[model samples]
Target chain A: MLAKRIIPCLDVKDGKTVKGVQFVNFRDAGDPVELGKQYSELGADELVYLDITASHEGRKTFTELVQRIAAEVSIPFTVGGGIHELSDVERLLAAGADKVSINSSAIRRPELISEIAARFGVQECVCAIDARLEDDGQWRCYLNGGRIPTERTLFEWAHEAQERGAGEILFTSMNHDGSKQGFAIDALRRLHEELSIPVIASGGAGTKQHFLDVFQQAHVDAALAASVFHFNEIPMAELKQFLADEGVVVRQTCK
Target chain B: MVAIVKYNAGNIYSVFCACKRLGYEPVITDDPELLRSADKVIFPGVGEARAAMEYLNATGLADVIRSLKQPVLGICIGMQLMCRHSEEGDVDCLGIFDAPVERFRPTSAVDKVPQMGWNTVSANGASDKNCLFEGVADGAYVYYVHSYRVPVCADTIATTDYCGEYSAALHKGNFYATQFHPEKSGSVGEQILKNFLAL
Candidate 1:
C-alpha cells in the first residue's frame, strides 16, 4: 500500500532556515543544509523550502540553499516562493531542487505555471495555495503568505492549476496555521474530491493523532508541518510508529 | 559505462542524478551504438505508456533494447513497458517479463489516485540476497507515483500493497525493475541504486 507522507517545512531567508509565529516576527533556526540533513536522516519523506524573502530580495535564495541541501541529502526536496518565470524554474532545477513550487508569483502570472510545466513537466511544478475560509463559509485563495486575497475561489484555482499542468497541490489553511488544533479536514477533503493530482496537506499539526485523522478522514497524500516538527513535538520515527499503530500505512526507517 | 535509455520520461534527471550519486556518470541517450556497447543499461520513464512506446518505436531503440545481452534495469513506467502488455496503451510491451500492467481501480474509500508517496517492500521468496535491495529491509519504504501497477508474477522480486498487493520490484535473468522511484527515495533509494551499480 502507498504510505502517507510526513514532510517538514523550512522557511529560507538569505540561505538560512528561519521560522516565525504565524508568518511574522521571524527568527533564525539554523543552517538550511544542516537542518535538511538532520530531517532527511530522521525519516522525513520530503522537505519543502519556502523563500520568504523572495519578493523583497528580487532573487531567490532558496535556489542556492537547495543546491547546498541537495548535496547533503539524497531525498527529493521542493523549493518555493518568489518563483516568477520559466528562467526561475530552470535555475531551481539546475541548482538540484527536485521540484519548484509557485504561489504569489503564480497568481500574478498564471501563464508562468503552464510555461514551466510545459518546459520541465508537471511533476516538477507544485502549486502552493495558501487559503482561508471567508465569512460566507467559502474558502478563498490567498497569496504572499496569506496576506493578499485573490478573486478566485480555492477550488476554482485548484482546478485551473491542474488544468495548467500542476502535478501536485500544496494547500495550507491560513486560518488553521500554527494553531496546533488540527488540519482543516474540510479543506483537504474538498481539494482531494476535486483534484486528481496529489494533495499535500500543510499547516496546523498538533499531535501524532492529527496525522492519523488527516490520513484517515481527509485522505490526503501527505501532511506537512513546521512548528511541531521544529519544536520536537513529534519525532518522525515515533510518528510513523504511531500511524502504524493506528493502521495508517507509513514508511519505517531501515533498521 | 551504463546507458539510461532516454525517451520522454519525467524522472530521467533523477536517475542520472542517482547514478552520479553512485559514483558513475551514466550517459542519458537513445543512440543505438552507445546503448549496445554500455556495460549496463537503465531504462526509466514517467509518463503515459502509449507515448513512451511510440518514442521507443520511432527511435528504433525498441529493437536495440530487446537484443542487448547486458543487465538492464527499468524504473516505474520503464518497468511496466517491459511486461507482456499494458492496458494503459493497449499496446504490446517488451515481453521480457511475463505480466500485464493494469490501471488502479477507484474502489478505495480513500479517494486518492496515483498512489503517490513512500511504501514498504517485502522481498519475494525467490530473491537471493541481491545487491539491489542491500541495506533495504523487507518492509522499508520507497517513493512511488503511479496509477497503474504490475500484477504478481514469477519474476516478482518484491511486493507492495496499495488497494491490494502488487509487484514492487522484479528480476529475471539480466532484467530488473522497480515500480518505485529509487532515485527520489532518500538514502534507502540511494542504496538501491548503489546496489544496482555494484551488480
Candidate 2:
C-alpha cells in the first residue's frame, strides 16, 4: 500500500533556517543541513527547504546548502522559493535536489511549469499555491508570500497547473494558518477531486489529529507542517504510531 | 571504482552520492571503456522511455551495457529500460529481462498515477539466494516515484503491492533492477546498496 507522506518544511534565508527550530538538539540551530539530517533521523518522510534568499550570493549559498544536504542526508528533499526560470530549476536539481518547487514565477509565467516538466519530467516540478479564503467566500490565490492577491482563484489555477504538467500541488491556506486549528480540509479535498496529480496539504497543522484529519478526510497524498515539527510539539515517531493505530497508512521508521 | 552510466537523462548526482556514502569511489561517465572495465556499473535514469533508449542507442551504451560481465544495477526508468518493452512511449527496450513495462491505470480516486513516496518491498519466496536483499527484512519500506510498472515474472525477486502485486526488483544472472530509488530510501536503501557492493 502507498503510505501517506509526512513532510517537514524549513524556511531558509541566506542558507540558514530562518524560523526558530527550538526542538533541534544540534549544535548549530540555524544550519539547514544539520536540521535536515536531524529530521531524517527522527523519521521525516521528506524535506523541503524554502529558500527565501534574494541576492545572487545567497542563491549560490542555497545551492551549496543543497549539495551538503544531499551528500549527508539519506532521504529525498525538494528545494523551493526564488525559483524563477528553467535555469534555476536545472541548477537546483543538478545540485542534488530530488525535486524543485515554484510559486510566484509559475503564476507570472505559466509556461515555466511546462518548460521544467518537459526537461526534467513532471515528478521534478512541484507547483506551490498560496491562497486565502477571503470575504465574498472565494479562495483567492496570493503572491509574494500571501501579501498580494491575484485575480486567479484557487481551483482554476490549480487545474491549469496540472494541465501545464505539475506533478504535485503544495497548497497552503492563509486563513487557517497559525490558528492552531487544522489543515484547510475543504480546499485540499477540492484540489484532489479536481486534479489527478498528488496534493500536499500545508498550513494550519496544530495537532496529531489535524494530520489525521487531512489524510483521512481530505485524502491528500501528503501533509506538511513547519512549526509543529520544528518545535517538537508533535514528535514524528509518536505521530506516525498514533496515525497507524487510527488506521491511517503512514511510513513508519524502518527497523 | 564504480562507473555510473550517463546519458541524456537528468542528473545522476544522487546515485553518485549514494555510492560515495557507501565509501566507494564512483564516477558519472558515458565512456564505453570505463563502464565496461569498472568493478560494477550503475544504470540510473529519470526520463521518458523513447528518448532514453534513443540516447543509449546513439551512444552505443545499449550494446556496452548488454555486454557487461560484472554486476549491473538499474534504478527506476533504468529498470524499465532493461525490460523487453515499455508502454510509456511504446518503445522497445533492451531485452535483458523477460518482463514488459505497462502504465498504471488509475482504478480509484486515491490511486495516484505516479506512486510517489515510500512503499514496502517484499522478497519473493525463492529470493533467499539473491544477496542484494542480504540482511534486509522482507516487506521493507523503500521510496518509489513512477507511473509505469512491470508485472511479477520469473525474474522478480521482490514484489511491492501498490494497486496490486508488481515486480519491485528483478534479478537475472548478473543484472539487477529496482523500480524504487534505493539512494533516496534512507537506511534500508543503504543496506541494499551495501549488499549489491558485496557482489
Candidate 3:
C-alpha cells in the first residue's frame, strides 16, 4: 500500500525561511538545508520550499539553497513561488528541485501547466490553489498568496488545471490557514472526489488529529504544515507514530 | 566514472545529485562513446516513452545504450524503456528485458493511477544477494512515482505490491532497472546507491 505523506512546507523569504521556524534542536530557522535535513530525519516524506520573495536575487539564493539541500537531504523536495515561465520551471529543475509548484502564475496562464507538463512530464508540475469559502457556500480562488481574489471558483480552476496537465493539486484553504483550527475537510473531500490526480491538503493544521482527520476523512494524499513543525510544536516522528497508532499508514523511517 | 544518460528525461539532476552525495562526481552526457566508456551508466527518465525513444533513436544513443558492456541502471521510465515494449504509446523499447510495460488499471477508487509515495519493497529469490540491494534490509521503504508498471516476470528481482505485485526491481545480466527512484528515497535509497557504486 502507498503510505500517506507528511510534508513540511518552508516559506522562504530573502534566502532564509521566514516563517519563524525555530526547531528545538536547531535554534536558527534561516538555514534551509539544516532545517530540511532535520525534517527528513524526523520522518518527513517530502519538503516544499516556497520562495515568497520574488526578486531575482532571492531566486538565485533559493536555487543555491535547493542545491545545498538536495545534496544532503535524500527525500524529494519541491520549489515554488514566482515560477511564471517554462524557463523558470526548467531553471528550478536543473537546480536540483524534484518538483515545481506554480500558484498565481498558473492561474493567470493555464496553458503554462500543459507546456511544463509536456516538457518535463506531468508529475513534475503541481498546481497550488489558495481558496476561501464565500457566503454562497462556494469556495473562491485567490491569487498573490491569498491577498487578491479571483472570480474563478475552486472546483472549476482545479478541474481546468488538471486537464491542462497538472500532476497534483495543492489546495490551501485561506480561512483555515493560520487559524490552527484544522483543514477544510469537506472542501478537501469534495476536491478529492472530483479530481483523478492526487490532492494534497494544506493550511490549518494544529494537531496530530488534524493530520489524521484530513487523511482518514478527507482522503487527501498528503498533509502539509509549517509553523507547527517549524516551532517544534509537533515533533514529526511523534506525529507519524501517533497517526500510525491511529491506524493511518505512514512510512516508518530510522532516525 | 559514473555517466548518467541524458536523453531529455525528468529527474536527471536528482540522480546526478545522488551520485555527488555518495562522493563521486558523475557526468551527464548524451554522447554514445562517453556512455559506453563509463564505469557505470545511470539511465534516468521521467518523460513520455514515445518522445524519449524518439530522442534516443534520433541521437543514436539507443544503439549505444543497448550495446554498453558496463553495468547500466535504469530508473522509472528508463526501466520501462528497457523492456521489450511499452503500452504507454504503443512504442517499441530496447528489448533488454523480456517483459512489457502496461498502464495500471485501478482496481478501486482509492487505487490512484500514479502510485506516488513511500512503499516497502522486498527482494525475491536471490535478489537479497543482488549487489544492488546489498546492505539493504528487506521491507525497507522506497519512494516511487509512476503511472505505468511492468508486470512480474522472469527478470523480477525485487517486488512492491501497490494495486498489485509489480516489478520494483529487475535484473538480467549487467542491466538493472528499478521503477522506484533510489535517489529520492532517503537512507534506504542511499544504501542502494552505495551498493550500486560498489558494484
Residue A78, model 1: lDDT of 88
Instruction: Score chain B of each candidate by TM-score.
Output: 0.95, 0.97, 0.97
Q: What is the DockQ of each candidate?
A: 0.41, 0.81, 0.78
Task: Give the per-residue lDDT of model 2 (tens digit) for B16-37.
Answer: 9999999998989999889989
A1-255 per-residue lDDT for model 3 (tens digits): 789999999988877888787676685668888889888888999999999886799888888888788778899998999899999898889888888999999989899999998888888899999999999998999999998999889999999998998989999999999999999999999988888889999999999999999999999999999999988899999999999999999998866
What is the TM-score of each predicted model, taking all chains together?
0.86, 0.98, 0.97
lDDT of 3: 0.90
Q: Weakest 10 consecutive residues, lDDT, candidate 1 chain A?
A: A20-29
How big is the positional error of residue B73 in model 3, measured in Å on the Cα after superposition?
0.6
Give the Å error, residue A187, model 1.
2.4
User: Can you tell me which runs of candidate 2 are displaced by over 4 Å?
Assistant: B127-129
RMSD of each: 4.0, 1.1, 1.3
Chain B TM-score, structure 2: 0.97
**A1-255: candidate 1 lDDT, tens digit per residue:** 677889999987787777632312223346777777677877888999888774545354565566666666777788887777888787877777778889988888888888976766667788999999999988889978888898878888999998998889999998899899999998898788778788999988999988999999888889999988887778778999999899987777754
lDDT (CA) per prediction: 0.82, 0.91, 0.90
Descending-TM-score candidate ranking:
2, 3, 1
Supply the TM-score for candidate 1: 0.86
Q: How far is candidate 1 from the true structure (C-alpha RMSD, Å)?
A: 4.0
Query: Clashing residue pairs in candidate 3, if any?
Result: none
Highest-scoring model, DockQ: 2
